[model samples]
Target chain A: MRGTPRLVAALCTVVVALLLQVTVFPHLAWNGVVPDLVLLAVVGAALVTDARFATLLGFGAGLLLDVAPPADHAAGRWALALLVVGYVVGRVAHDHQPGGQRPSYPVMLAAGAAGAFVGTSLFALSGLVLRDPAVGVGELLEVVLAAVAYDVLAAVVVVPATVWLFTREPGPRPAQVTPRLPRRTPV
Target chain B: MSLDTRPPRQRPVRQVSTPRERLEASGMPSRSLLVALVLACVALMVVDLSGGKDSPIAPVRRVVGEVIGPAQAAVSEVMGPIVGLPGALRTNDALRDDLAVAKDRNADLEAELERAGYNDNRYDEFAGMCQMIGDLGYAVSPAHVIGYGSAQSFSDTVTIDAGSDAGLRPDMTVLNNDGLVGRVLAVTSETATVLLIIDPASTVGGRVGDNMENGMVDGQGGFEADRPLELRLLDNTVVPQKGQAVVTWGSEGGAPYVSGVPIGEVSKTFEELRLGTFRAVLEPYVDFTSLGLVGVVVPAGDDQRVIAADCVPGGTR
Candidate 1:
């Protein structure tokens, strides 16, 4: 956690995932479906790292996602969604795992599912409620499918690499138990 | 070495104090996460039910947004060349569908142009219209939008190339191929900013031909959102329906906006007990998103003269 190289890698990972979310992911729609790579990464981070680390990553990812094209909602919506997703995932994962060693594929996948649900639901609801933009059920379902698919795939490959990365040095200390006001919004 | 050998550095920064404290310290909500979620939801509902008025919360959101917008714009710019790659990778079937749609749209446009008799007046129309309109004592100046207005504001605004050098003035109405675009908001020698009527802050007097109940057209969507605007009937006696050609009543008013400028038609109308009026939203004639060549109405005779004084000291110039 203290190593500069690892910190940079995590930062780069978050950026790359967010870049994909904004630039490439939305464009890669199949029958009007696109992946939520940022959400996947947040869940992926929570699965391996502690709540503190996950929350930070979420803030960054959320910020990037907010700025992207098709960004048609309240600003903090994505950040808030990602932060909540990461925290909830990290806490629940810790609870289920108990020992809290490196995360396994199942744990990462579970975290991914939960994160996607929370992220997409909050994002859509913000648009529907706060903005009063009329959206249909079909569009929401499409986002859900995309998020789930992206999460499943990301968890398959990224979790192992993250586990190795964390195990290489040392993992985050432990879940912070209490949430922080967070200087920056977590991606 | 024991796994517990290392001592803590600076006591871990007290990262996550407690969920409640975290929520409270943020100055947003100090409660259980569930409570916070409920509060946010309730706030959202209140904002939504308030009938989509522009609120002060946008600047707060924009502050958060401004931090990341530039980076996203940069990435979008960088990815410009990479855009067409994915489209090219589409299957033949999808390509055929796209081709068919394009062809259909092309045919429809061609027919419309033919019907409008653009071929007959292609060369003479602008010059002739310019002369005809100028003889009527209206100074016409041309303008083009160079770029978008402020990104933080959801209202559609554009910066035009013509300004005071062309004798442009504030409140000068702007029009495009379709209809009224907006009125000039700010101006300089080289450029002038026009606030599109689609913005929530913009209010224009609208009355369809002889409807007698010339209602007020207010921007439907709030500041941070992009949605079709609404035109509510200020006078409750008349209810407006969809597809009604809503035009500016320049025929009646000597106002600079002109009476007959085509605003959007009635897109939505509803009666709510709270508002107690038939509120209808109009879809503007000019598609603000893709506006290009536009006309600026500079100060012209009676139109310009009436504003200062109806006296007309020396009579007709």
Candidate 2:
């Protein structure tokens, strides 16, 4: 995959993941915490794409989550958290395998868990600093644990699928020309 | 028959062509750019926090809501049943148990209604809102729950299909069939954001029982049947009893909440040694988890006569 196409695909994946995160995931919440699909998408993008692209993608996706309906927290909280997640995940994953080989499932899952923890903690800590009415010190621990667990479980399926989509080669095109048969008009 | 059909296998070769190419392919972002983006995020949060209701971020939030709100509503409508199947099945037995309890409550309400001589026409109205609306004479705009939960925060909120266009405004009280749901926090053209009362940050002024003892009700974060709202009576000497009905104490002009709306029933009572005041736990009537249709109380226009003017000795207005 080339640069522009990969960027477009990554953007679409993040948007779709965000939609699922806010809509479907809420219904499937475990212990009042929904899996951060957008974060997982960023981690997946980090594993396959360069650090720069993943970081920007993370910022944009996080901003969307922050501003999306039903969100009452300060804007940019997720953006800051996810930007860091993207940068760390992309740099670590890229450095770990200079050969550009696709990371194994365990490696990808570990990255997802790490990204989840980093993103969720950063967001929570900022909420605490801001004195966000919604963030209680006692509840913060439960939220962080549930968010990381759910993201890791979701990462098992989401990360590998994202990697395949981002890295898969285009299919061969059909032949555009036909061979000419010799003319037999003289006979 | 001589068409070339071999698979392209030069991808590896292209990747490893040169060290410079490998470095370029690695796609590591420059530290300066990361720092710049991080700084930008912090600035945004700062501006948003200090700006309050008129924050510059409100426009951005509104734009995002307008763009993505419909997609969320569509996904919620189409996928709600399918995704909720497992949960529905899990709660099926619990719902069966509730049926018996509901039957008993129904009997009690029916006898009360008989004694009160309530109108039959009011019974046809949807949910618990109709009864409250009838009793209180509140004008309410009905709306459907389109989405739930914030993507990254622990705030308990829901997006409803109605918005400013539907006469909804921030600070308006929202209720469902069962009881008080929450209050509208923000409104766009076609959708509104509601902050649920079950959120830890929420506090509502409540009046307990016929004595109408005033108290402050605080949410305990999450909504579980066992987790109830904590109520602290203003008068330290009076102790509220179990089974006492708690209702909203109505805000002035009713911007955030109206008076006489049933909030919950006192489940247990205990003395708070620290405050030396009697406190009680109230199990809210509305179930926050399975919210669907809800009503936003729209204050009646000045030109219209207040229907419940005589009900309260002093009018809410």
Candidate 3:
């Protein structure tokens, strides 16, 4: 029950992000590479959620990407890659201690960059393994670097906001204290 | 002994594990569950990679596509007008310049018409006849591009709003004003997917210029923004020269592409001495990066109007 609202919000975010990824991002592509907003969202989700949840989210997100139009590769390659990403990011997130604490900007940026690198690498590897490798190693490396840089930059803004929005539990209002009135001098 | 002044040193207590601790030790949120999901995904991948269109995943993919395709179409429809604004503005500027020239031409044409005493009705009829003759050979349906491939792996395709509802079918040739764009790959009730000629998997039988030398034009996966397509000649007797026009050698009755449609121009020619054949790199006529209004070439039936030979004076067939 507690996860319902967050899950809905996450789903909305995923839909919007996927839409933008297919539409507006193509216009903003640099060197034929657009930032993976969904991957960034997945990483953000992982930071705020448990490993199992992250894994599930990753599979769902990757599945959406796989089935989407213009998808040429085998289905589930992205799912596998992103599943690994979500689980690893979630596990790594546990290292920073006390749950529910918002990650700092630097930490979020690192996570985003690392997640993008890992996710893109795994995607490329999966492609090579499951399908024909249309791109070479050098190109693959370039794609990974571009994706990481772009994701890091995006994460700098998106991660903190997402963590605050989804992960942080509101603190209880400070216990209100009613101070005792000074004993009226026996009036 | 019963009332010892000093209390015995407290012994260290061994920690007892709680249910939660046990759950955490076994990997909370279910490690086995995650593993099962992963294995399922792997199995799906194996099935998908091993099978072609008939794979179980294809229908699932199609169903999922139908779910998202409409949303994408709506977004593209909204975005289309906005994306065109810049070009529209540029065109407006150009139109202003052309307007004065057009006015001058109009005045001249008016004077000529007065001198010639042109019959408006007869001229309209003649123009209609000419247009009818022009459309008799072929018919085209206009379509709007709804979306482009989101991932690099599938970068060579685009989705269009018009589909079987608009008479689109698989292998129908699509073209822009510039030249050949691609062929229809798949279609649903209201939408179709086109595999752009620039895709790596695409191969078009091409003929070079007036020499009519046959060759194959293949897409290079658009690896670099600079180079979009590649070409390889088949015959050794005649060599394809640089800057020669490349046109579709075409298919039977032009099912995939119409005969003699412009594909591209040769950019560079490479000689393979060992294979005794030449390869030509091409600069495609169509700028695939920015796609707009496209036309689907469909076969026109025998109901076309043919002009009478007697209509032309001093003209012989």
Candidate 4:
């Protein structure tokens, strides 16, 4: 709702997600696949927010990740993927309430899975278009599968929490009841 | 009856949509905004893909790295001990096993040393390296591997701790005790990304042992353990010899690599049906898989030292 608070919450979520993705996830990797916590956060944020904000969040988060270490490909590839993913998730899982409504867990989970798949696929496509030697079709498919699975699993915890935090607007209030005046002393 | 008169006189009211209702009607992210953002992202992607290292986002990338590098280093420091606990125990066990074997070897070496009057074979290794440094007249700086490239991209790169700060520059040759490792791809303030010779994009001019038959050694894009590198003979005049050693053919300026640096030994040969050229699969001397402490070749300042007279092969002593 408010600009400063929204910005603060977004920054905090993205930073925490980025830190965890880069630092902690590498150690937790299985089959060389680590959950993309940043993408999960973006989906969660998008689920509670609008498409515009979600797209912006995705772009910003993706940019940070691209520039960060261990990122071997050209920059902006991830940003494009994340931007598209954010927009898609925001549109798909959108809950438009005068008072914002957080998406249900199942919705969040599906959205997270879908977002990761789309994001990784887009990244792979961009790499392929650039003639990157690394982006083989089989490898890309495996990566997409792993990323989606991991994102969904992690989203079970992170998505709900992020949606709850971002969905700050209060729900609709009950109708007010006016008190009846006493029968004018039986007049 | 008196209140009814005023109530009846109430004017007709107009209903106005709330902000939320209006937003719902307008839809999330107007088409124009979405189009603008998409176009912007496309522009960025195009620029980044084509711009190489001189892209406009280079500064942004550098700044982000500088900010995040310290944080990552701190995280690595804090988490290293915890994450490495199990590995450390395993290493302890391995060391014990190695120690037993080393003790027997030590005894055998001691007996040999008593007969030959020398004990440390390691001395010869270092002496050879010293001789090499003297011969090549290139300053060598040792560095340790800090990180590997992202698995998702399957990039054949390793980050070394020594960088521009250590007088290491891009395209400089990297080596270990065995032989040529790779060349420095990019250097930051504190780290450098080394593109190993086993990378698909990597190609080096190489010559077969002694006969000095020139060829091009290319990476097979193979990551499997100890995959043999491919060397294609250029002249096609000489017969392919098995187990022949391959060394750098040397560049004009010795920027990326110098001549006489051993690459590998011929393992297998293949004849391309179309090209009629023989491609030899050479097993590289340096194990690209398990890289450890490595040396970067920097330029040696003017130092009056003849190229080890023995190295010149029958030239003036």
Candidate 4 chain B superposition, TM-score: 0.54
TM-scores for chain B, listed for all candidates: 0.50, 0.55, 0.51, 0.54
Question: What is the per-residue lDDT of model 1 for residues B227-317, given as tens digits with 9 covering 90 to 100?
Answer: 5566667677678877787776553333447656677787677886787888776767776766666767655543431212112212322
Could you give candidate 4's per-residue lDDT for residues B1-317 as a string of tens digits?
Answer: 35554555455586588776666563477667668777777788778768878888788878877877787788878888888887767676789999999999999988887867332433443354445555556556767778888757666889999878777789988876578888899999899999888888899889997688899988866567455589988876566688999988888788787777789999888888798889888899887777776767776543222222233322312
In Å, residue A186's CA in model 1 sits off its true spot by 66
Clashing pairs for model 3 are none
Stretches > 4 Å off in candidate 1: A2-12, A52-64, A67-70, A98-100, A129-131, A154-167, A170-187, B1-317
lDDT of 2 by residue, B61-142 (tens): 8998888789878878988789767766757679978998999999999998896634442332253555567677787777
Misplaced by over 4 Å in model 4 are: A95-99, A168-187, B1-27, B88-317
How does each model score on TM-score? 0.38, 0.50, 0.48, 0.49
Best by TM-score: 2
> What's the TM for chain B in candidate 3?
0.51
The fraction of reference interface contacts (C-alpha pairs within 8 A across chains A and B) present in each candidate is 0.06, 0.83, 0.48, 0.48
DockQ of each: 0.06, 0.45, 0.27, 0.32
Worst 10-residue lDDT window, candidate 2 chain B:
B305-314
Report the C-alpha lDDT of model 3 over B67-99, residue by residue, as the tens digit: 777877887788778767876666666898899
For model 1, the local distance difference test gives 0.65
